[model samples]
Target: MPVLHALKRIGVLFLATAAILCTPGTPGAPAAADEPGWTAEPATGRAATARPYFYLEGTPGTVLEDRLALANTTDQERTVTLRGADAYNTAGGAFAVRPATESTGAGSWISFGAAGTVKVPPHTRAVVPFTATVPPASPPGDHPAAVVATEGGREVGVRVHLRVSGPTLAALTVEDVAVRGKGAGTVVAYTLVNRGNVALAPELALRAEGRFGEVPGRGARALPVELLPGQRVELTEPWPGAPVFDKVDLALTVTAPGGARATAAASAWFVPWAIAARTGAGLLALGAVALAALFLVRTRRARREPPPDGAPVPERAGQTAPEHELTGTSR
Candidate 1:
């Protein structure tokens, strides 16, 4: 029995050594159905075969157990390294496993009975036992992780979904909302932050009002985002045919699962300077023309009307009036 245990340990070491020694092949290439290779799957149990993921619901201070199956489909011996990593959704919304160097949350809470490595003979499989212990301080809601097998710089993983039972809160907020660009081509940008312990798929509604009245509002649109707890993302929406001149008031409303609602508002002024300048110049020209016409009419009226009766008549240089000659006694 001692010799058998030694042999098993040796097999595990060999698996670990192979993972480090082998050169990496092409990254993310799927093996053909008929090709000889290896695969990692969930062990046969409650929902392993159909779901292929460890889904356990437990409260804080609870312990759950599971198993993973590693298979070698080739005619030669295969070795690999077993590890655990946190799981997250990529930008494209695909489920992804974290790098081997990092582990947190559920990944750190899980432990395996087998060593870091395992060896499987040709056309054979190995089953490894593992356990997940929820900490007393862990928050409520879903925690996603994965168990992976690495060989020759390639990895295959199976998901581990651990849910800590408690009140699930879906709180979110809209922040830093603003409008960008001008005229008919404009966009509204904002940040969406998850403030609770549950994931959310949010729907957004954008409305804008000008000095005159409400402009065309963009109806609610569902965003293609799987927002995780404590994560924030910046996003933008098109505001086609935006008002060109006015004080615009913008508002954004976001709603998600569990009746989560948040709203943010911003104000901006849009003025077409070129058009305003032209309109002011036209008004000034019209005022000048009206003033000139008034002046001309007043001058013409003074010339056409007779002057007030004069107190004295004017005298010529060589011919003076009789009254002036008699008073001066000289011409």
Candidate 2:
């Protein structure tokens, strides 16, 4: 009972263990053995596109447990047989028929359903649960396998592969940082995004440019950088002025599990802000007024202009109004 209980997970699979390879089918699927009174319709089922597919969680390989679901998608009594199911090779995919390898081990971890059985009813769906096991010592990589079911004389089979991708680890992605600044003691800000799958402790070492309003001669400094998958962190560093440097470059480095590393960097423009000069305030105000005026003029024009015929209607871009009306479609 305990063994069976452990096997109930969504990732159950079965290994062939070089056992007596038994594949059955009927007349419809002649590819399968000749089973009498059994007519199989097309083995119709949707591939599980998300995790927990086939009721198994992690990447394939480690003796996952699951059952392929195939329903009678046609009228009249039809039998669906799974005979010689396996990963479709590149060549096989061209022909639309996959080549599958039988599994080898049942592993001692779990057992969710019966290893071998076949009998599908008309108008109903059948579940072919399977288990996958990654040899404890097996190297991490992609390994292929398949399951076979048979019904009728001809065979209607689906192809699936066993995956043996190695260890589970998180990944980190650092995005390019943007900065605006110039002059001494200027601070350039940047954002770091974590694109990996794992979480990371927020910490990083900083190294950035000192020329062109950059942190001059700056060494590594600690930045609080805790983040997780798809997370981001913003950082700003004060510029250290060096007479020899006109611009500064900001750089950061991060370390994670399995010796993985991530980095972000930014360049500080050397353009001196006019705000540092007395005329800077007046120039800033003038620029703002000009922008506001431009915005107002654009708005007034939009409001005053009218369509030639009826009220302007929203249409898909690139399509003319008459073309859209006639076709009842949008570009």
Candidate 3:
């Protein structure tokens, strides 16, 4: 009876081992590639408001508080370094941020605690609070900046659209309107200058009046630029419909959001100089021939006509007239 009891106990142990080996995995374990990467953005508010970028406004010599959220979804921990960076527009007018070392504007005003770094665990998120203290003499208007995060060789930036609270202006000007090339390859070039103390998203309209009538003109369209305060950008638009042989007066009207508008104009002649030059040469040749003919006719008339009174006459080779002979009297 004791031997039979031992055999039953061995069978139960074998079953229990098989069940444990067949189990898939523990609960709450991370699945493969479920959360692949990480992200950096503005932290959500207590009211659960999702923000695209950080917008902070304050008067001069004030401090504004904000928080940044860093999320890591991978299986390992992520170490990210944070820094403030000044924002500006590229030559082509694309928004960009300066490197952390070169930040001097609103970027320098931001503070990210004692150590500007955060370590996020796998499948976890971290919130870091920061402050931006405006300088006492900071200028009014938009002081664009960003919070930059770096890990390994990759960098991600979150925009901080900081603005100093004061009277703002959004004025701009269109300058140096010019037409280049000719015919099918014509292009209209101009420069946009932000005269006010605020950034501007300018819309441009191109109109032209040719000698005959209204020529091809461009309707109002938003330019691919964000003109920063006191910043100017030179841009060109292709005009495939420019006239082939007409003098045109081009007017460029640029408008911004804050009741800002400006107009600049230029005149261009699209003559086919090759054809004109050939025609001009032909006309000059005709003029020269006509002038020469007139000279020849005048010379012939002078030779055929009698000499004026009191003019001396030339003597023949064998005869001479007496000097004392009187006119209309026989001697």
Who wins the lDDT comparison? 3
- What would the per-residue lDDT of candidate 1 be over residues 138-175, giving only the tens digit for each residue? 88987866677787766766656567889989889999
Candidate that beats the other on lDDT, 1 or 2, i.e. the better one: 1
- How many clashes does each candidate structure show, in the order listed? 0, 76, 0
The CA lDDT at 53 in model 3 is: 67
Query: What are the per-residue Cα lDDT tens digits for candidate 2 across 175-243?
Result: 656554445655656555545443344345667555334343445544433343344555665654433
What overall lDDT, based on C-alpha atoms, would model 2 receive against the true structure? 0.43
Write down the TM-score of every candidate: 0.62, 0.29, 0.71
RMSD of each: 10.6, 27.3, 18.7
lDDT of each: 0.69, 0.43, 0.74
The order by descending TM-score is: 3, 1, 2
To one decimal, what is the Cα RMSD in angstroms of model 3 from the true structure? Answer: 18.7
Which 10-residue window in model 3 sums to the lowest lDDT? Answer: 1-10
How well is each residue in 159-187 modelled by candidate 3, as lDDT tens digits?
67687879998788888889999888899
Highest TM-score: give the candidate number.
3
Q: Which pairs clash (backbone N, Cα, C closer than 3 Å) in model 1?
A: none
Rank candidates by lDDT, best first.
3, 1, 2
